[model samples]
Target: MKGHTIGELRIGQSASFTKTISEHDVYTFAGVTGDLNPAHIDEVYAKGTQFRGRIAHGMLSAGLISAVIGMQLPGPGTIYVGQELSFRAPVRIGDTITATVTVEQLDPGRNRAVLRTVCTDQDGTCVVDGTTRIMPPKE
Candidate 1:
């Protein structure tokens, strides 16, 4: 499927996806990325950290934003170029995260788009927020 071209996009255009963090997901992410940090894998070790329990890898939630951009908005053939992110809160296993992407700005002349990306937990806490730039497929 072709992606939304610049001409078809508008400011405030948005999309999202939600997922519940699970132990298997975290472990799989850790195994694949080789980021076996204690906070993500070792409950006993994590208990001593500021979070007082295990927390999912921050990028796991960030990946959800990618889902929205690649599958929802300027979807399918969209090319991800740049991303800036900030992890605002800890996300634990079993927490549901909703990742949202809104068109905050567009540079049609450059075939560029900047989207406001946010990930919120079930409690409505903003666990992650950032911006991403993409070159939406013109076709």
Candidate 2:
């Protein structure tokens, strides 16, 4: 696995990944996680609720942040030990979401890093936000 060691990290360093939310993505996520909330899968039911239409699961958008941390910032060998996530807005199928991770603090003594993570829709609205602690790869 390829990734930056904690020694190589600097506060404010960042990376991101973007993916369009698709029906398949949502359905597959629901199946994989058993998070088949009617808000996400039942359009007829959703239309009667606050969202007025089917909305994707919040964690599905947050998973995009994992993509950034695992494949971009700390890259392949990073190990997440903690995270805090806030779901702010609904993510609908067809929305293009961008998940970004920025190095917020580095703890060389403990081989850990604090990263600020967020997910925004194409409209630039933040849909998810949080901070995560990880043990970055040593090599």
Candidate 3:
């Protein structure tokens, strides 16, 4: 599960992880993070909103991107330094989400990697798009 070291990374290196948003997942995320927004937790309340239904927390979907950075691309020991994200669409329960991270730049002297991060629903619609900076593990 070791991640690529700074020197080993390259532009275009990529990785991905996929997950289905489930009722249990949404509930647990809400409970754990204490983000009790009705749009994410209350179906009845959500129906009146613009989304017209419950949507998973944007961060929950972002966490999928984190999963890829921590466990797949740069893998274990990666230190997430910064991220900038845009939530493009609602993620409803039962939607399968795929998170992908691709290396866009590598700065070996500073031991950093800049990656293009994205999460797409089953329909291939981008739900989240962002850039992440990380310090890859030093071997």
In candidate 2, residue 134 scores what lDDT? 96
Off by over 4 Å in 3: none
Candidate no. 1 TM-score? 0.98
Whole-model Cα lDDT of every candidate shown, in order: 0.95, 0.94, 0.96
lDDT tens per residue, model 2, 52-124: 9999999889899999989889998999999999999999999999999999999899999999999999999
Show where candidate 2 strays beyond 4 Å: none
By TM-score, how accurate is candidate 3? 0.98
Positional deviation of 67 in candidate 2, in angstroms?
A: 0.5
The per-prediction CA RMSD against the true structure, in angstroms, equals 0.7, 0.7, 0.6
Separately for all candidates shown, the number of backbone clashes (residues 3 or more apart, or on different chains) is 0, 0, 0
Question: Which structure is stronger by lDDT: 2 or 3?
Answer: 3
The Cα RMSD in angstroms, rounded to one decimal, for candidate 1 relative to the true structure is: 0.7
lDDT of 1 by residue, 1-139 (tens): 6778989999999988999999999999999999999999999999999999999999999999999989989899899999999999999999999999999888988999999999999999999999999999884
Q: How high is the lDDT of residue 99 in model 1?
A: 98
Per-candidate TM-score against the hidden true structure: 0.98, 0.98, 0.98
Expressed as tens digits, the lDDT of each residue in 1-139 for candidate 3 is: 6888988888998999999999999999999999999999998999999999999999999999999999988999999999999999999999999999999999998999999999999999999999999999998
Rate residue 133 of model 3 by lDDT: 95
